[model samples]
Target: MKNTKTPDLPLSIRAIIVAFRVFFHLGWTKISKKLGTDPTTVQKFFQCMQRLANGSEDFWYLLSHIEPSGCHHPAPLIAPGSEESLEVRKAVLKHKTWMRNNAVNYERSKANLPPLKCTTVQNICLDFKHAAANPKYPKRIKRKRQPCKTALDEEDRSNWLQYTQDLEEAEAESDILTNELANKLKDQIQKLKDTVSQQQKNAESPGTLEWELLQQKNMEICAYNDAHFTPA
Candidate 1:
């Protein structure tokens, strides 16, 4: 059988995929014009990209960023120490544990439960974010996500594993480099208090992109200093 597992994507490719999805919502014609491609081609390419993003880490990250605009059936604000709240907490924990061990198919589970009561607890527990926040429930420990793998020969599988490992290491190293650079800049600024004055001079210069960026940074710094260092 051919290996059918979806391949991992680098951060840059993931960002592009997210942008494509966002832009796609505007219209196919707009995307086609921007890409200088035919509408049909853009649509087909988008379908492919959507499938690729479906089960990827970036896709989950994108999902995490989504915020519900409104809740029609908002959960009632039960006092934490009250009898109703105690029962609600128990029901939430019970359903949470049940869902963890079983397929999270609500309708299928509903079939096994007594009529009318079937969806009662399920509906409340379906609000995973709220249900999972039971202060009485022990916090679930998080683990690093494992890469999805496809069936392959020993050699090919080994190579794929190595590639994923290297990809994760590269991402970690990139984050470390960013932190190191920021720290270096902070130390330099502290050691040379005149650095801000020098940057201000460069920022004042016109026409160049570097000067434009410096001016923007100076403005941001001024706003931060005003907010933090100024007296009330």
Candidate 2:
């Protein structure tokens, strides 16, 4: 018997279904304002479309009218020893060479800094190694020596001492800021882990059936929206 159900679908209903498929593939945000419908409603409609399309021949026929052509062809597979592979290797080598040249240029630019005394350079390197070995090791600040202020007037002596004190205070403040930032980041990570654990427990709980269903629906909506909607 001829399917009476086929003729029962109104033309307007079919048009809306096709329009929704296009909009969902293109993006829901694009048509929400034009359709005067809430984005959430459009999103739910999209999920319904997906479920219907998956199970119903009528829905599949409606969807096929809007389904894009030429999208089903498998991407061309590249064989080993192909020109494409050789070109990719060449591109990688070119990038490596460019990076090496930039590093050399950077080091050359820094070469003009005042040369460190052999003893000072050795001490700095040693301190750096110690800090790497022991996280709690204090960093040494480099201090530039000024000419003896005692040989100058009393005003010069007072100015030198003030400058040194200011330098010490600035370093202390910087260390405090670094410690505070590390602690803040650690706390944030712990909070994120706690939130994830709570969500996993909720998912596994018997009482969270509704919540899980809502999440599944939401994922379907997102998939439908991604497939149909066009970005502005």
Which one wins on lDDT?
1
Which residue pairs show backbone clashes in model 1?
none
Give the C-alpha lDDT of model 1. Answer: 0.52
Worst 10 residues of 1 by lDDT: 64-73
Clash counts for the predictions, in order: 0, 10
Give per-residue CA lDDT, model 1, range 1-232, as digits (tens): 5322213323443344447656445465665455444555445444555454564435555544332331123544544345443454454444443432132234335546322242443443344443455457533322223455557999998999999999999999999999999999999988687876666677677965669897788999999999999987
How close to the true structure is residue 40 of candidate 1, measured as C-alpha lDDT?
58
Can you give the TM-score per candidate against the true fold? 0.20, 0.28
Whole-model Cα lDDT per candidate? Answer: 0.52, 0.51
Each candidate: RMSD? 27.5, 35.9
Indicate the worst ten consecutive residues by lDDT in candidate 2. 84-93
